[model samples]
Target: MLSQKDEWVVEELVPIREKVYQYLKNEILKGELKTGERLVERELADKLKISRTPIREALLRLESQGFVTTVPRKGVIVSQISLEQVLEVFSILSSLEVLAVQLATERLDEFMTKELDELIEETNRLLAGNEDEEISQFHIRINNFLYKAAKSPRLYEMLSDLVDYIRAFAHIGYEVPGRMREALHEHKDILQAMSERQIDKAMKMTQDHIENSRKAYIRTIDSVKKK
Candidate 1:
């Protein structure tokens, strides 16, 4: 079904490309690289201990994903997440997540529901402690489970891309005063709503939570601009 050269290319390049992609994506999302910062191909190649070809390929993929923008002469720059962009993304995410909640509620088996309940309890425990990093990881894990429960491959793929974009901006809000606590409460509300199969309440809670996060991020951006 495949040409020898094509198969060889796939075998050799996919792993390297995936590694490059993951490394760059993590650096960007973690704010190790800031928005609007230029990414020099050679510099990244050296920093990543890889050749330019793979670096270029990775950058191209990032560009496609809205994380980077290329200017003709100036090279690639990390695209800043604007307030408008944040609002638009959150709007889409709210709609998608509402759909996900609805689907997950309708389709999830008892075992899956119990698993989510356990995750919520674990999240509660983590939040009770001061482990911010663990809380964030658990929050992401819960969202991943929700995505799986949603069960629409196309929606899942789009949301996955959107979540990555949100993560890049979300790290800014993570330090906002009271944001972590607020998010914890909001997540608990969402989980309770899901547990009760209260679709409307779950959807509204998700929407409100995302809106609050967007506002927090906007405030943070404004403070940074003033400084």
Candidate 2:
């Protein structure tokens, strides 16, 4: 019931759109897409060896995920990562992550506790080696494990979207000196609190960690803007 051109378009674009989305997401997370840079659909399509439709679709998805924004009658552009926005995000995320850790601590068994301790040890090693990428991965792994242990589908879904936004700004905070070391120490404290079954202490430690990270991100962004 469709025209040949329309069928061809659909066949060609579906996979291309998915691939483009993945590529853009990674680029944004890696800070390769500079803030305020214009995103040209035609150029991107050509670069990716695809048509405009897929590029547009991918851009729209990125916009929804807060990686980019579109202006009426204009075009898409990378969203600027501001210190204020970072603080706001951290405020909300800190609460959610604390809740997740609290729930996880209550529900996790001995096996999960041992797994968390192992992850902490690995994260400490990565931090000691100054392996920023591995440290980031360990943070993600810890959060994912806690989310899974929490066993709350609704909370996981909410935090997943938040995590996407957090990742977009991760490179900024990751580059800050001493931030990784502080994060490692805070993560250890949270793990210790959890291990001791001190739910309130774990929650507070998680909140404090996020607050400190937010402050560091704000300071870094302010310095960057000044330069």
Candidate 3:
């Protein structure tokens, strides 16, 4: 059963089914719903004070998104993040973000550069304060800032979806021991390359940053499994 804090309120604007789907997806992402945890429709319906139809719809949607699996006897269970999925997601992100950085190097305006600088400074502060979670959020902001500088809507949309998928499956890369500082240093290098309008260097740095992040996340997953 979901805790009272996790209960979904009936929102007026969104469709009930869509709201239900978002609620469930968020729970899975936040790890409130553990991997392989059984989700019985009747239980969810009773808990949410909603009908079974919407619960069923939401589960199906979550299944399609790789957030849950429908086991024969187990019903819907939260899906486990596999090694293959992690590697694949990082590979795609490396290619896509390299291109985004290349484009952004040529396109970043003064205001965009200022924003990136601000983000970098803020990340430095977060690091000094040992605010791990807030540092993770600044990483996202930095990526989004680069994507915006790329000025490619289609690329931005694709990257956004990939980012969400990766966040859902893999633990935050910065959480790995010593990775936070290293990642920030890499971010500074990438920003410097971009500031100098070195397109090729920026792209290569972006690729390297992502590869390092991939390694960090894999290490974290492996350590968890060992436990």
Query: lDDT per residue, candidate 3, 1-227, as tens digits?
Result: 34563455566787789878878888877778888899999998888888899999999888876788988876789887778987998999999999999888888888888876776677667767876667677777888888888999999988876776777777566578889778877887888788878889989999999899899998887787899
Model 3, position 217: C-alpha lDDT score = 90
In candidate 2, how many Å is residue 158 off?
2.9
Higher-scoring candidate on lDDT, 1 or 3: 3
Q: Which stretches of candidate 2 lie over 4 Å from their true place?
A: 1-16, 225-227
Clashes of 2: 0
Please, what is the TM-score per model?
0.86, 0.82, 0.81
Q: How many backbone clashes can be found in candidate 3?
A: 0
- How big is the positional error of residue 56 in model 3, measured in Å on the Cα after superposition? 3.2
TM-score of 3: 0.81
Candidate 1 positional error at 119, Å: 1.1
Q: What ranges in model 3 sit over 4 Å off?
A: 1-13, 172-175, 222-227
Per-residue lDDT of 185 in model 3: 74
Checking candidate 2 for backbone clashes, the offending pairs are none
RMSD of 1: 5.5
lDDT for each candidate structure? 0.81, 0.79, 0.82
lDDT of 1 at 98: 77
